[model samples]
Target: MARVARTCLRSILKIVNSTLGLVGIAMILYGFWMLRVLQRDMESPSFDDFDSTALWFIYTFLSIGVALCLITCLGHISADSSNGICLSCYMVIIFLLLLLETLVAADILLNSDWEKDLPEDPTGRFHDFREFVESNFDFFKWIAMFIILVQGFSILLAMTLRALGPNNGSNYDIDEEYTSATLPLINPHSQTPPYVVGEPRFSIKNDAWNANK
Candidate 1:
């Protein structure tokens, strides 16, 4: 029963870890797509000069981290110690990546109006810039926030899964634990002091015979 339980647990952990890894990769690619769109729309003359290069680096790192995490999780599920450190490393990377994304999203939302107050670029036309943002604003904001939340939760879950150790594998020493628990109960009075060589002895047999006589 114990062996079966461990096997089931390992399988579940692997599945969940793999799923989250895929999610991380997808988020990175999505961020890249967003950046591509921004690059094309953003002109040097425009007042909207938010740097996205930092975010690109962050997303790229997260993508690589997620790939490594997936491989490590598979190793764990298979009861292999090859990638034991993968999950912990992955969690740290995810937290940093997601936190950065959330901060960028917040900055953009709060400073959207502020950008308009800046001196317009001498070269690029600012025609309908506000309307463009207004049309796609919610879509971008919600997606960014949602991805960050997902990454945060994934990091937490990955850490928990790593701490849980291997659930489905039977390499653990269950027999040792069982024996340790049962050994004390097997002979509770064994530890009590034994009869010494010259201990006091009462002669109840002789006393009973004399009383009868």
Candidate 2:
């Protein structure tokens, strides 16, 4: 049971963590890359009027990257150590993150005038970000969907890992969890009370003869 559970849950968790790490690194790199674009555009004079508000997007990207890196680290620690404290903290953070993203995603998809709910952007950086999303709707949409799936999977894995508790150094241990446990016989009156364990192994000659009779 432990081996099977690990094969399904722990292995999937590893994949999710790796995916998160890659996404995080990509975001971090993309943030830097955007900064480069900003610098170049500013220098090119064609974008001299670049709204400083664009910094908002850059900062948000970097912030998300940092957050994801933190999550990935927490996930790794929780999965490897299976410490109660670590797992607890990881679950709380992941759940909060999922909630936040869910809310934002819901707003974006459900609200027709989502932009109106946003604060007025004097620097127009928000407008630019909105425009970017609108222009690359398909790509961003898929990425967001993927992220949601990954987060959901992570939550399930955490719960399952918690239920399973720390591995006892062997997968078969789970299957034998109750092997030595005292079990009551179904026919308690017919069998002796101490017959909780399986009946003593013995020749069944008497039973065979009885069956023949």
Candidate 3:
């Protein structure tokens, strides 16, 4: 039953890791799309103000996406090879990512008083910012939340599988010491003697004959 549970956990981990890999790819694609959209927006004649903050945000997303994809590959390789070290590293990476995601989510949720601080031009960039805070920001937060949940579950499954240890049976190699130790010892002196016929012989010296001589 324990072995069965381990097997099931391993299978689940594999699926989760594969799904994470796809998520990573999706993140990278989304980052690229965001960059393209930003570039298009920046090329507009009336869009003279270069928002360095927005540019940094896009770059951050791109970097995170790349990191996710790389970590996902590491996870897959570790799982395939059953490498404890690699799995450990992968777990650490996922944990850090989870932490960062949580922080970002919290920051967005906590400092969401942008409406009161809106600039005079409420119909321009300020409006867009408010719209994002209301809609797109929430969307990003939810995505981060999903990623965190998946990563946490993956870590749990990975740890469980690692704890189960290898499934192979006993070693197949011959053990010479054990073989010799188990063998019966032979003692030649312990054998029974052959049956002998009944015979009695006696020898005596006569001292009187020597005296006569």
The best candidate in terms of TM-score: 2
Supply the TM-score for candidate 2.
0.66
Kindly report which residue pairs in candidate 2 clash with one another: none
Candidate 1 lDDT tens digits, 1-23: 65564455455555545555665
Tell me the lDDT of model 2 at 22: 85
> After best superposition, candidate 2 residue 61: deviation in angstroms?
1.1
What stretches of model 3 exceed 4 Å from their correct place?
1-7, 49-54, 112-133, 136-145, 167-213
Residue pairs in candidate 3 whose N, alpha carbon or C atoms collide under 3 angstroms: none
- Kindly report which residue stretches of model 2 are placed more than 4 angstroms away from their true locations once superposed: 1-4, 45-54, 116-129, 169-213
lDDT of 2 by residue, 42-135 (tens): 6875554645654776788899998899899889888887666777788888889889988987897799898777555444445676788899
Worst 10 residues of 2 by lDDT: 178-187
Model 3 residue 210 lDDT score: 62
* Clash counts for the predictions, in order: 4, 0, 0
lDDT of 3 by residue, 92-148 (tens): 888887787677557756877634543344114434544776677778668756767
**Cα lDDT for residue 198, model 2?**
64
| Candidate 1 residue pairs in clash (backbone atoms < 3 Å) | 6-167, 6-168, 7-168, 10-168
Ranking by TM-score: 2, 3, 1
What does candidate 1 score in Cα RMSD to the true structure?
A: 13.8
